[model samples]
Target: MLIGEVARRSGVSARMLRHYDTLGLVRPTGRTVGGYREYSPEDIRRIFHVEGLRSLGLSLSQIGRALDEAGFTPSTLVGDLIRKTEERLNREQELLERLRTVDAAEPSGWQDVLRIVELLHGLGSQSAARRLQAVLAPAEGVSVPAEMLAEAVLTESDPNVAGALRWALARAGGDGVASVASGMASEDVDVRRRVVLALAELPGDEATVVLTDALGDPDTTTRRHAALALGARGVTQAVPELVGTVLTGPNDVEAAELLGTLAQDAKWADRIMSALVYGLTAHAADSAVRMRLTQALAEMPGTTALDTLRQLSRDDDRAVALIASALVEKLEKRLDDELGQP
Candidate 1:
């Protein structure tokens, strides 16, 4: 077959065929009287081989190596193609996410679009300071999309930056709640923790609802954080978790303090009293637990908590007795001071 016939049959353009010949990729096996190129059957087979390799994303040089190199194997090249394809897919997914986030912002114009892109870039920046600035960036003009803030806060590891991102998300109202809530179910514990922290800062019924649901998280720390945030929001559901944290070592002090805050209200007073007293029986033999319980009594107001403190003053553990007796003294004086107040 002549070069033209070869081009027609193989779908390879004549110019490309000539270039292939120049590169020694597929030189015709013969020439006519007019000195025009003519391809033999074997040459046509080589041309098909090159085309087949190119279909697998091989560069021209790679195709040349695959066809000519004695030791060349398709295994290594196929592996590399698979890796490259995966990388490309990941990049495309990230880009699509960014575009969706930008679209969700409802930009007024190209300028607004550009502003959001810049903020998103900053939020994802390698520099912690830049990420912080992105969350705190002056929103006097264009607002950063809530989803962008939500995603950033979920993955943020820096304490200071996470706080700022939370604040930003909160100011965005409930916009990021859905995104943050999704993070609550993430397989990654860190992601779940970060999302909960952000949810705590957010102001909305959505945050309250999510935190209340988080009370059952299998992760101890996750539930504790959720309970603390819920307690601050006046959700009585946090009562049990807060009380449990008192028995558990971690966050016991803060938990005790939060429980005391809950105790101040008459609505939760009896429940709080009963729960704390029950906590006593649950840890009656543990002197350290008794001491923590005594310390927590000082935070509760009114006669019931006062009476409980008096009984604990006589606890069998000497250290628990001493701590309880001191707390009683402090409470007696504090009660007297309160009575004197106008």
Candidate 2:
């Protein structure tokens, strides 16, 4: 079959078929004398497998390797992929557990829906606009309860939610809802906290500005939540304040744990080490925070950071010793891997 007929039959686009050919995922079994490509039934069958694996988030490279390693079927490789996915899901679950107490996830209120929808009215974002359409799509004839509709929107893809609400608001044609969102952005404490949280789930210049302001909120909970939300949003505007807060602020435990978890650039290691040193000198009020910082310090590959961590190996906390043991094992593995030693 030609590419178009294959696309019609298999539902994978011709471009994607060409991509698969390039990736060695599917290949033409033969070519005509005039140079037209011809695919066998076997090639079409393999394309179906390729489509399924792509849907499961396997990269072309990964799918190729898996196909070579397993006997062309993912069932043999699915167990390994499932295990890796489970590990990632476990880490996310743990983070969610820790964050739940810090900030509660409330059901979206009427004003919340109104604000999201109205923002979409002026919505310039293509991604947010598309999301808004999907949410209000079922609203054509079926009257889903307001709360249920809000929940459905909230749970939908983030962009679609933004798009749907904006579409709804544009259709409704109201400025009053914008006033509500803008007013909430100016409020102090809980209202601002909730606004920042909701904005974290949204995408816009306004949400970015609101988040920037929320990080400076007088309430510690609000500030902490803002920091966390902004970090998840990848808004670099909060990094400096978040770093400063983690090093010197009152919420020592949460800040330390987050900094340890989030900070990746080696350039920030010195600043983090200084903060850990300060925490160690003062001694953490929370043992868990102290242990986490100690572990983070141990993760640094430098001699100075290792020496500092080693000095604390005799501390009352057994977790510190375990971290040191792990660090030593890591160093040994690095030497073995680099030196090609057994």
Alpha-carbon lDDT, every model: 0.85, 0.58
Question: What value of lDDT does candidate 1 attain over all alpha carbons?
Answer: 0.85
> How much is 173 displaced in model 1, in angstroms?
2.8
What would the per-residue lDDT of candidate 1 be over residues 49-105, giving only the tens digit for each residue?
Answer: 999888889999899988888998889889999999999999999999989987898
Error at 15, model 1, angstroms: 3.4
Top candidate (TM-score): 1
Weakest lDDT window of 10 consecutive positions for candidate 2: 98-107
Write one digit per residue (lDDT tens) for candidate 2, span 1-342: 777788899998888888888878788787778776678898898888888888887888877776676556666467777888999999898556434411222315655444444433322234655445445553233222323232233333464464454344334322322322453444455455544455555555665666777776777677766786676655555555555555455554555445554445566666666766776677656556566556556544434366666666666778776776677666656767778998
State which candidate has the highest lDDT: 1
- How does each model score on TM-score? 0.79, 0.41
Off by over 4 Å in 1: 1-10, 28-48, 260-275, 298-301, 305-308, 316-319, 326-342
